[model samples]
Target: MGGDRDEGDSRMSNLTGLSDDLINAMNRHDLDGALRCYTEGAVYVSPVGVGEGRDEIASFLGAFLTAFPDVRWTPWSRVVVCGNVLITQWVITGTHHGPFSMPNGEIIEATGRCVNVRGCSLRTMDGDRIAVHCVFYDQLELYAQLGAELVLPRP
Candidate 1:
């Protein structure tokens, strides 16, 4: 990925191995291995917030891994690569046996309940490493599985 390609080009690239390595590292609960997949300036965006670089990403993932010690992200769909970007649909499953930190600074203690949620990750590749990683998932689904009550008006 030397230069940026036009979005209208729609030509797909093959970066499956990069994503595979990352997912496998995460499944193995290897923080260092996962971190190595990203560049030092990589940006990881999630429902929580934006992780500007490797250190921030590490902290964010550290909390998540701590909360879900046995978490695993299983691919539910084929890997899609567009130019220098990679997308993967996944089903993450784990048990809540530790404290989970929320984006808004709230901490939810372990309820001993298991969670299985469908999500996706979009990554921008910079050669052999990821320059950006964005995560998508249902926040409500996670809370509902944990038995948290929330009332909001539908517009």
Candidate 2:
């Protein structure tokens, strides 16, 4: 998963033109381009946390782009679009090469481990811009790949 590659990130987004625009921007490592795909009041949700508004979205993306500068979310399923919702499954591949911050504000240092995490996203579109985006992924798998196991409290 850590191999030098683009994670097959060139497919058109299923949501709308905005979706494709953001994917293209991310593949090109253009944060500004990616951010332009969302509206000012967009809400980005993930298993890690929810980021409301463009500022919060940028901050959330900053963490990801910082942690995995070459990260890519490769589509693993046909995009499903109904009404204003666009859903797709993906294989998120990346290498931990910098500080990775958790949703709870815990920052993990670089481990250089590569992760091929299976995940999915549901994006709701308002007109051509994204209104809300939700992603699902396993945090435990991500942490374990970086060499840490969850310490569950015994009952």
Off by over 4 Å in 2: 1-16
Candidate 1: stretches off by over 4 Å: 1-14, 79-81, 151-155
Local distance difference test, each candidate: 0.84, 0.78
lDDT per residue (tens digit) for residues 91-111 in model 2: 878889889877676788989
Report the C-alpha lDDT of model 1 over 22-109, residue by residue, as the tens digit.
Answer: 8899899999999999999999999888999899999988888888999999987655555687788999999998898666767889
lDDT of 1: 0.84
Best by lDDT: 1
Native-to-model Cα distance after best TM-score fit, residue 36 in candidate 2, in Å: 1.0
The C-alpha TM-scores of every prediction are 0.85, 0.83
Q: List the residue pairs that clash in candidate 1.
A: none
Scored against the true structure, residue 101 in model 2 reaches a CA lDDT of: 79
Clashes of each: 0, 0
Question: With candidate 2 superimposed using the best TM-score fit, by how many Å does residue 83's alpha carbon deviate from the native?
Answer: 1.7
